[model samples]
Each structure stands twice: as C-alpha cells, then as structure tokens.
Target: MNMLIFKRFSLTILILGTLVACKETNKNPQKKISETITSETQNDFLGNYVAKEYHQRTEGYDWISVAVRNKGDNTIGISVRSRADKKRPTCTFDSKAFKVNDSLYRACSNGVGILFSFKKDSLKILTEIPEQADALQFYCSGGGNFTGDYGRIEGELDSSQIDPTLFTKTLELQGIGFSVSSFARNNKKILQILPYGLEIDNSAITRTLEGSIADVEIEDLNSDGFPEILVYLSSDGSGSYGDVIGYSVNNGKSISAIYFPPISENDELKKGYMGHDEFSIIETTLAQRFPIYREGDTNANPTGGIRQIEYQLVDGEASRKFVIKNSTDFPEKN
Candidate 1:
C-alpha cells in the first residue's frame, strides 16, 4: 500500500512538470511573432520614390529621384539624385527613419539623422534640428537649370507646353548673350560703353563689367536711328579724375567722345573737377540730355562737388553746351 502511494505521487509530479513546459513553449512562439511583425512593418518604407512637385523651382528639370535603403541592424539610409544632372548627387542621409504611406522606415544607426514622411506622392522631410526643415525644402527644390552664365536662373516649364530639348537650347543661346529685341534681330554683338572709356568686343556677353556707374541715359543722340549711351565715371584710387564718355551704337559701335571741361574754365564752375576721375550716372527723363557727375576727393572726409555738363548729338558728333560746378546739389533741369 505504501508502494502504490509512492507511484501515485510520482505520476502527479510528472503531470505538473509537463503542463509548465507546455505553457513556456507557447509563450516563446508569441514573442517570436511579435519580433517578426516589428521587423517587417518597420522596414516597409525601404524603396525608391521620385519627387513630383520638387522639379519646378529647381535647376530647370522635371523630376528628382529619392531612394531609401535598409542598412542592417535597425537603421536606414537615404539618397537623392537629379534627373537632369545625374553626375552631382547632393548628399546622403543616414540612420534616418520615418513613416511613409502608413509604414515605418528606419536607417542605419551610424547615418545622418534625416527623416521623411509621405503625403501621397510628395515627401515631407524632417530632421533632428528644426531649422533643417527649411534646408530640406531647398534641397528638394533646388534642381532648376543653371545657365552656367552669370548665375542666371532658368525657370522650369511645363513639359506639355514646352519641349525640354528646345528649352535647353534657348537657355544655352541666352547664356551666349544672344537675344531678340525690337531694335535688332539676331543681335550677336555686345559692347561695353562707360563714361571714362569704351570697350568693344564681340564676346561682351562673356565679360562682366566691374566699376561704379551711375545715371545711364539711353537716347537717339546723333539721330542716326540707333541709341547712344551716356554715363558718368567717378574716380576711386584705381583711376584718375571723373570724365564723361559717350558711345554711339550706330555703325556697329564706336566711342564718340570723352568730355572734360577746358582747364582754363572758371574755377568756381570747376570746383568739383578732377582732371580725369570717375563718375556716377543718374537717369532722369528722356528730354533731359545733360549728364551729372559727382566729384569728390579720394581721401577720407572727401569734399562734395557736383558738375553738370549739357550735351547734344547732331550729325554723329557730340556738342557740349556748358558745364557748371557747384558745391551744393544741382537742380534737375525741367
């Protein structure tokens, strides 16, 4: 009877141990399922997307490609490339994680902290620093066509309305300084006309003029049917006293004259005169044909002086009326 009791106790202990082991086995599977779901859901955003609206404001292109890839070990990586210029891929975002289309995305642990979300087809960029929001907008939209000229921006156009090939050609033409105007067609020549000097060049569009020019007056001065430009040259330390140089656009391009009052002229009327200095040009009305030159010393505390020179173009020649110098401001001729 004691032996039977011992056998029964042993059986009871075996049954309890089996039940506990079964419970533990069931819990392990549940934990595993949870981990699998997290991994699958978190990586749903790994893929490539194209920027739809971002192509409009940037370097004259229609689309930019954005890519998100999983970097193993719970991290993500992001990159961007332009459809127009593929050679220049801007930057990379590492360790980035965000939601896209109701899916979670994550980047590598050691990458840039850039995150992005999707609203339909557009990307909503997020960064660890709030100020980076503005920067991301710029990055996405800054792919417009660069004319490769003097930083002139070429606007992106609707693909349906304009041909991309033709648009690019137009931009290239403008870069070379060719344009259509009412005055001239296929105007391939460019000239630099300044008050102190004139530079005539077929490649004027490629060069940028550096110097202070004030008060530009464009007129049919010689009545040769072409516009003549008048400007004032003021003297800094680099050059001499201010003088007026006139250029005639007629007959291609030519310097008509450099105006400097005779030295024997009255001292009061020449108070602001620098033998050969620089000047600024102020634009008044078309009827006023006089050029006003601002004169002053090159040193600190330079004295203020104003000189007014009246000019008329008759038969392709510049005729000077009179010059008046004043310490005070010169009144605009009515």
Candidate 2:
C-alpha cells in the first residue's frame, strides 16, 4: 500500500480502539458506594441495601441504606445513612458490627445496641435489648428508630448521596461510638470519623491521612467510663512506619481530641526508634511497642531489643494527650 493509505488505515484503527475503551469505561459512569470492585449483584450481603417508605399521605420520608463491605470474614464494615428534611439530613446510624454468633451481628453505641441479620435478599436491623431500644430516641427524631428491613439495591443508591470510601469500621465503649473511614480525593488520602448518639450535635471529623488505617481500638484509658478511640495508621512503603490518631470522650457529654507525641520529639524515646510501632490499650493505659535497633542494625534486624512505652491519659491545656508513664526494654528473642 502507499504511505498515505497505510497511515490512514493505522489512524482508523487507533480511533476505533480509543472509542471501544472509552465506551467500556463510560458504560456505567455512575459511581456507587462500595469498598471494592466486586460483582454488583453478588448473592452475598456485601452490596448496597436500601429502604424507603412511600405512601400517598407521607409528608417527610425516610431513605436509608446499609452498605456492607466485601470482606470475606464475618466481621464487616457498615455505613448506614438516612435522609430527611433540612433539619437533619445525614447518617442516622453509623457503627461497625461484629459477628456475635452463627448468624447474628451486633453493633453497640452510646448505650444502644443494633442487631443486623442478613437474609437471602435483604438485611434486617433492629434493637434486641429492650432497654437499649429506648436509647434510639437520640439517633432519630419524630419518634422513629433505625429498626427496619432493607432490600439489596443491586448497585446504585443515588451515587450523588454516597461518597465512595476505601474502608470503614467502628468501635464503641461506655456508650461512645466512633465510625472511621478512609477515602482518596485529589490524589491525597483523607481520614474521616463520625461520632453518633452523642448528647451534643454529632459532628464529623476529617483530616488528611498520610497512610492507611492498620487497626482500631477503643478503651477507657482515663478510667472515667467514657472511652477513647485509637486509630492505628501505617505509612505506605516497605518501612511501614506506624502512628496513631486518637480521640477521647468528654464525660459522656461530647468528644475531645487526643494527641500522640511523636517519638522524635523526645531524644531518649527517639533513640533507636525507627518506626514499626504497634499500639494497643492494656487495662487503662495506652501501650506502644517497637523494636529497638542498634547502631549497625537494619530495619528488619534489630539487635538491641524490644522497647515498650506505656502512656497515661492526662488532661492537656488544650486537649487530652498521652503521656509517657513508663518505659521497659526486653531482650530480643533467639
């Protein structure tokens, strides 16, 4: 073929390929609320389930959805939301439910308990404990509670109403609950925390996350009955440096922020402290453990020992913070 003819043919093929790719992607431009790219109609309960009450004489309506993550384990993350009038138009209930028995999952927050049972085609959520059911008044207004049945929503729940999230989990202690989630926007990761069933206005917290959430723990560090929420974060990379973002509940009235001082801030603590921090709540104290590296040791091989630092929850001038209570070191295992 001539050069002109050959070039035209090649250009035509390229145009066709681009169109096909664009069509494939843009076919379902609707962004849905999901933790992963799984089957939209999967038989499992890891998809979006929604419920709405519509009647001829209905004034204000309730549109709620229960989004279950596709994690294979029985322990799953859930996000529940309800739309109402301009007064309160947000999540009526948001908590992570843990597997209780063979077929029951329960989430307790702010003295209220919610049981989630999955059916073949829908999800049933309600309060089992009669006493906790009374606490539902704080979550919803107009004499309503989040006790109903929701059917699977195939895929789309008005994507405009839901923000796609990477992960979500919740923990509650002493009637205080925290819902944590991570998402990406503008090429940056963002961490969001939603506290529900509080006496004060349930304000949502959002901040930039340098890494991903490794784990979450809740405990009453101060022994004041109100619990503190700790979010363990691991920086993305081979090093996998760890940190924490914590918050404390305020006398069962509201929530306060908790500060975790960086190890570099203290010369002694910073000694041989090369990330890899693991955090947990032991009794009423916050404990952080890491491998102590010697001068010539590598990140993977620390010849010195394991160092653990215990922190006590103390009141700071601005907010509550974790203070080093004691430091102990142990020899490395053979």
Candidate 3:
C-alpha cells in the first residue's frame, strides 16, 4: 500500500456535490448524528455569507466569503474562500458539513476540524479542539490566526472576492484517492482529476465536460480490493439529464475507464426513457433510476411510472464496461 503517513498537517481531500467537490483529509470518522433533522430546519443555513473588518469595507482591505447550498436528502455543502493576496494568504475549505445541532455544524480540511456556529444573521467558526486553531495557519501566511466570521449576504457574493473554483471533491477507498475540481476557462467547462498512491504514476486527467458534475462515489465494485471512482454529471436546464464517468484502478497499479453506453442507443431500455436519472453504488452493483416518460408527457410529470436498471462491472474486449444485470419497471403510484 502507499506509504501515506498522515501527520500534524496531512492532506485530507474533501469532496462535495451538487456540481463540485474539493479535497481535505477527514481527521476523524464521520459524525453519527441523529437522522431526524427536518428539511425546513436545514434550509435555514443556505445562503451567501460575507465577512468584513468593522462590518464595512476599507480600501485595499481583504475579506472572507462563505457560500452554503443544500446537497439534497438533508445534506449541506459549504465553501469558504478569501481574496487572494501576494503571500499564501489564500484560505480554502470546501466540503459537505455534518449537522451537529440546530445552530452548529462541523467541517474539516487538512486535519483541522472546525465548528460552524450560527447566531442571528452572523456566523463564526470555532475549532473542535482549541489547540487546532493554531494549525489553521498552515493555510495562510506567517502562521496567522484563522479569520472567518460573516454576516449573511443579501444576494450573491461579490465576484471579485471569490476564486473561480466552481465545484470540487476527493473520494478515497482502499488507500487510493481522486481529487476532482471543475471550473470555467475560455468559455468551456473543464474537469480536472488527479489520483495518488499508485505503484505506477497515474497522470492527472483533464477534459472538457458537456454537462456539470453532480456527485462522485468510490467503491470496490468487483471486490478486487482496489477501488473505482464514479462521477455523476447532470445537464443544465429543464431536462437535467444524468450520466456517469467511471475509473477503475488496474490491479492496484494504474487506472482505466469503465464504458457506459448511452440509453438512446439501446432499443429495449430507451422505450420510455427521458432524463432525470439517479445513480448510486448499491452493494456490488451500480443502480440507476428515473421516471418513465410516455407519449405526450411534459418534463414535469411522467405517468408511465419508474424504471430501474442495475449494471455489473465486467471486463470487455479491452477495458471495462457496465453490463446490464437487471431492469425493472414499477407502475405509477397514487
């Protein structure tokens, strides 16, 4: 296995979805909190929040900004950024935060976990352990103090203050990890993926994306002891069509892609298929589900019920492909 000794300042790649994820080491096991939180209570935390010295702007003064969004199923994704300066004055923490209480959530980046405490229109961060506050200096200049306090911004965050990173995430399994990020450059949406801990060097993967990324999942689908990374993407606009990009570690040495044929190319599966698909790793199989569309149906509603298709990852003539294992249809519910 790769000799990755997590130290006082080890890198913990963090991933978040809804289009992007960033990297960071999760120093501790994920918090096992009650699953009884309501959607309304969670939605209260979604917004663009900003921090300014004296609650007012000063010439040539820098600032910190936080953006919060819901990742569906009661998950909250938070991003913290700051105006870059000459030195390593940049502070970045992007990850899905776990709810700790009605007014608090905790997120970790680079082995240092911090709590998000919300009160009224303002928000502040306190480290899970007081000593860890000193570690935050690793992300900034001169080993300074962590500075991220903000009042909810009424609208969007000022474009000039935040960096161009739109989405990022890192997913790991069996000691292998993939750091992913998406940004706009030269009018094109670019997707960059980098992998670490392979005996053979796996160069970073970069390509143009037709649609925005939705989520990324990792699993050893074939029980190979190695891991595979699955990236789900969704098209913009009403259709919200979904697709997957997969990479499998080659015998614990290298990486390769898994072929996923388009539904429009298949006669049996495309009979009543539209967009709006969902994908997940269910035990040993990759499962996809979507509302079945019949003739004269609008995008909003489909009366034809739902269709679920499960695929098993198997070797093809050369690389790998997800072969359909089972397909089922359920009638529309009342």
- Predicted structure with the largest lDDT when compared to the true one: 3
Work out the TM-score per prediction. 0.26, 0.53, 0.73
Cα lDDT listed for each candidate: 0.34, 0.67, 0.71
In model 2, the worst 10-residue window by lDDT is: 28-37
Which lDDT tens digits does candidate 1 get at residues 212-265? Answer: 232233444444544555544333353334434444443443334434454336
* Cα TM-score of candidate 3: 0.73
Return the number of clashes found in candidate 3: 16
Summarize candidate 3's per-residue lDDT along 101-171 as a digit string, tens digits.
Answer: 67666665545566676666667776665656887765455556554578887887666545677677766
**Candidate 1 off by > 4 Å:** 1-217, 222-224, 238-240, 251-268, 272-307, 315-334
lDDT of 2 by residue, 1-334 (tens): 4333433443344334323323422333222212222332322667777775422114555566777763223346567765544346444554556554444555555444467777666777766554445566665567766677888866556654443565566666666788888878999999999998678857999999998776677788888878888998888885678888998888777887899988888999889888777665666777787778889888878776667788998999999999999987776654
Better of 1 and 2 by lDDT: 2
RMSD of 1: 31.6
Give candidate 1's whole-model lDDT: 0.34
